[model samples]
Target: MAFPRVSILPLLLLLLITPFSSSLSLSDTITKDSLYQLCSQPTIRKHFCIIWLTNDPTTFTLNFYGLLGLVIQKTQLYGYKNLAMMKSLVRTTTDPMLKIPYGSCVTYYESAIKSMEEAIKFAILKKYELTSEAAGKAFSSINSCEADLAGRNTVPSDVPLRNIRFKRMCNIVRVFSDVLTAKNY
Candidate 1:
């Protein structure tokens, strides 16, 4: 039997477009469960990660890099908050002992904020190692601040809580960056 002739162009176009379209849709369909799975990776606090990421509506639309960027942004904001708190402590406290540690915290948080900004830039560029390094630096800064406050007998209760939360955010960035690096994405 003879077959009717059909153009191969349409078949070629479909073949070329299938993979790209499917991948695009896969990325676009990111949901809360997928985010939870990502956040539930070992060494990450699943609950904390989920709550923070889901708090912003835009997070549902982000891929891995975008999610990491959001975490870095949150870390930067927390750094600024800590800086403001330290500044307030330094200004309002009459005790020289309190002033010494709070003053140091002010400097540390300033450095942390700078590091977070660097992390954000590196994350955007998909330089996962650099992003992790920047986040680690920010984490170290928070640790230093905590240590300084530890020696003081009159440290404010809220200061410690803020430091803990800020450190957690930095950890999330570091872990997520490491995952991206490992995947070589």
Candidate 2:
């Protein structure tokens, strides 16, 4: 007895489509719940992590290392912005006192940018410990800039706010890198 032609076509189509559909679903496995779980790590700021990741449409399709790379890029951009702002201030300020802090901030931001570059390299290599360490160094650079500016009588209002946001980015990178490291071990 032979199977009908119509029945054989349906079976063949199902077999062909099943693998493609399942692979697509697997790529989309980073749901809200999973994001919540990732952000819930003790050192991570859950709200910031959730908001940042959710805002980026690409986050849903990326794995953990890819997410880390995204965060690193954002942090690097922040560092560059801060560096440029400080450089501008240093050059334009007439007051020698203001220039001192602004110059210090320029150095700090440069260091932060360097550290973030290192983080990106280590992240690409899947060296989670070095990635976390580089992020920590970047965080420390931001904190140092903040503290240096705090002591000055005159400072830009936006500097403090930028410092806060930049620190948050660094925290996310550090925590994510740490989580990845722990999972590997």
Candidate 3:
């Protein structure tokens, strides 16, 4: 009984100290729980969701610095259905103009454009106030992705799987960028 009491004391102390060790900072985006409470207010919920949604895209930029690990975590939470579709399209396409095993790298590019367009629309409608320049920036990301696709496709060799993956990852980083920069979100 004495030994068990001593052991429990140490365990309890460890648990208490573990939580207090973390530092709080404002650069941190507001928490989901708090955001949810804000959302319940009716007037602010849409803006709240949109703001969080928009913040997701700017995550991939060269300048991205805030809460890097958390940003990735949120993007994962969003679950890239579009990105997965784009990846599958790129992986399967064999022709550039028509359909073969896939359409080569262009398939991914097309999917990206489609996805960004939808994301912009999402921002403009529910959280229009949350997005940068009111979805204008998100719109521009589509064009930038297009330009990037053109460059990658032109550059050179047959689109390897690695190349496809790299384009898929790097270009979508802009999604987070547009979101974060968007004034409303």
- Alpha-carbon TM-score of each model against the true structure: 0.82, 0.80, 0.24
Q: Answer with 1 or 3, whichever has the higher TM-score.
A: 1
lDDT at position 166, candidate 2: 90
| Cα displacement (Å) at residue 110, model 2 | 0.7
The Cα error of candidate 3 at residue 173, in Å, is 9.6
Which predicted model would earn the best lDDT? Answer: 1
- Per-candidate clashes come to 0, 0, 18
Please write out the lDDT profile of model 1 over residues 1-185, one tens digit for every residue.
99899999998788556542232322343588667766766778889889888898988888666777778888898789889989999999978878888889999999999999999889889899999999999999989999988967678778899899898899999988887787676
In candidate 2, which residue ranges exceed 4 Å CA deviation? 1-29
Top model by TM-score, which number? 1
* Rank ordering of all candidates by TM-score, starting from the highest: 1, 2, 3
* Alpha-carbon lDDT of model 1: 0.83
- The segments of candidate 1 whose C-alpha lies over 4 angstroms from its true place after superposition are 1-29
Candidate 2's TM-score reads 0.80
TM-score of 3: 0.24
- Against the true structure, candidate 2 has what lDDT? 0.82
